[model samples]
Target: MIRAYHQPSAVEEALALVARGAVPVAGATGLYTGRSRREAELVDLTGLGLDTIGIHDDRIEIGATVSLQQLAMASSLPGMEGARLRRCCRHVASRPLRNMITAAGNVAHSVYWADLPVALLALDASLEVRRVGASPALVPIADATHGGKHAWDGGLITRIVVPRRAGTLSFGYERFTRTATDYSLSTACVTLRVDGSSARDVRFVVGAVSARPTRLVPVEAALEGSALSDDAISRALAALDRELPIAPNYRAPAEYRRELTQVLARRALETARTWAARENP
Candidate 1:
């Protein structure tokens, strides 16, 4: 049996309640497990009415309680960064799931092969973290946690801020899994800034192959300022092969994951280059 439920109207009050025993819920998307037990104190963040989206200075701030559907269904955004990330949101779980899943909840309890973190990482998104008494601070998407996980301790995620420069990035992702809803067996997010045929900067991230999604910096370094020729692709792939050491999984071996990650990274770069050409031309 659940003990109490509170729906505060203010962010601070909500934080106070959340700092107590209550767990904040935006859409109740992950609240149940087909008749499983429920948390004792449920903090209903929906009533806080934190849902809003807009550009502030150079970052787009997205409320934590905002639904995935709301983000995906928005007609106009100033840039492709939000739109591209929203496209990934549309592919998450299903339409109904998107309608209910909250951005805060999704990242707070990110599981294997989750969508938001992968895309957020690519966009260089930052999190607006608020606590009961402390003023909110922005943490980079890559370092949003205490011990390298997304747990906010006693803090609440008010919104996610994606920097405007994030839009300048071109990206692609690949998921090798059984079904659309099934968590990715392995997933990759590739982003790069290109000028004509030259790579200005690059980042490659792979999910479900480690304790957390990891950035392939060596792969990025290898591709930086390099033209997407056969030799460049080969070198990037080789760099990934040397840098990424995958752990064994029940479904596949470590060697297999390393191979898959390398292949996926190459393919993602190829696709991202194609996307850049279309977007830039």
Candidate 2:
């Protein structure tokens, strides 16, 4: 059955309610639709003044409560940092769903098919979370999703921080799915920082094909200080597992998903390479 729904005016009150077993839900788009049976108090975070966006010192701070629609419509990022995020947000789902999906909710729930995690990983984003009776803490997206997801239990993500790079940032993203709103079969997010034709930093995140997102560490190392030419891209692709252990689903076979990952990842890196070349030219 249904019960209490509280919307606290302050963070402390919200924390207290959660400490006492209240479940936090903002943009309840994913929660209400899912076939969940257990019920409890719902702490609506529509208030508490957490839905603000701020920019400073080459970084953009996105409130956890900020809706995907809000982010999709953002005018600009100071240095165009994490530019790929806007596209990711815009395509998260249909218009109605995007309007009700909160950034915090999306990451907290982290439906395996979610795109935000890969985007955050590519941008090296960090999260700010508040725990029961404890001061707020900053955690890297990688760390927060590591080991066990229990890191956010009894806590709530307050904001996400995207650190801007000083040099030109080249970003590319691609998602493979049968339909526009259908969950992706595989997704790739890549960001490259190039200085005078040499790659300074590269982050390539592959998701939606496994239980957890995985970074191509060997590929990233190979991309360093080199222009991602056709040969270079080929070499990186060769390093990937011939057959990734992607869990099979009704939407696609595991082997097919692995092949798609290799293709999309190549395209993403190649596009990023072209963007980097533009910086030096």
Candidate 3:
């Protein structure tokens, strides 16, 4: 059934409408494909000026309505971080879909196959959320996306803030799919800093095999202080099964997905190690 459509020009007006049960629409990609046939009022957020990408000295703030294509082409993001994010963004569907999918919408309505959130989790990004009758809050990507808790909770995500790291920082991303635009079978993203011969601040995230992107804490611990040697990588791989418990999916069996995750994760880590050596040396 068709219903009324309202375009709010301000964040506060949008939040108020959302609180009153008006379905918020950004890119409308998910809304169109969604199976919800019930009648609903739509509140469009495109006019709220939430599409700017600001690059600062210590952090990069991405507005919620920014398109994936815009993010991929942003010239301000430099070094390995920029390359990593661009690669992840390019892997999502196709150029047309990327033009229509908003960053906040992808993260907020995250599916198992979502790719950007994996990279964001590895980067330790945070979301600036605005709610009715409350001050805006910054929510960490891990807390906002994982643990079955909705970060917005009827509120709106205004911006996504990613902290910039200084010196010898490297990142790696990997995703598997039958076709270029097909849903991912497995995905992995890694980021770390190299201090001389040892690795520091290691963050390894796995996606497409679970409900949400998950950080492999034990695996990170195994590689954190090591030199990313063969032995260290082996130990980290051994911790993978325990840290990442894959759930069954119709696209693939649980065992298959687990094995695929191991392969993708290994490739991502190896890529990161190579980049670290190249950048640090």
Candidate order by lDDT, highest to lowest?
Answer: 3, 2, 1
CA shift at 191, candidate 2, in angstroms?
Answer: 0.7
Cα lDDT for residue 32, model 3? 58
Tens digit of lDDT per residue, candidate 1, span 91-158? 77788888888888778765555677777887778888888889788888788765644547577898
Please give the lDDT score at residue 34 for candidate 2: 39
Q: Which candidate order results from sorting by TM-score in descending order?
A: 3, 2, 1
Error of 2 at 79 (Å): 3.1
Q: Estimated TM-score per prediction?
A: 0.89, 0.94, 0.95
Predicted structure 3, TM vs. truth: 0.95
RMSD of 3: 1.6
Residue lDDT tens for model 2, 231-276: 7777777766542447768777777888898889888888888777
Candidate 3 deviant stretches above 4 angstroms: 32-39, 145-147
lDDT of 3: 0.86
Candidates 1 and 2 compared: the better one by lDDT is: 2
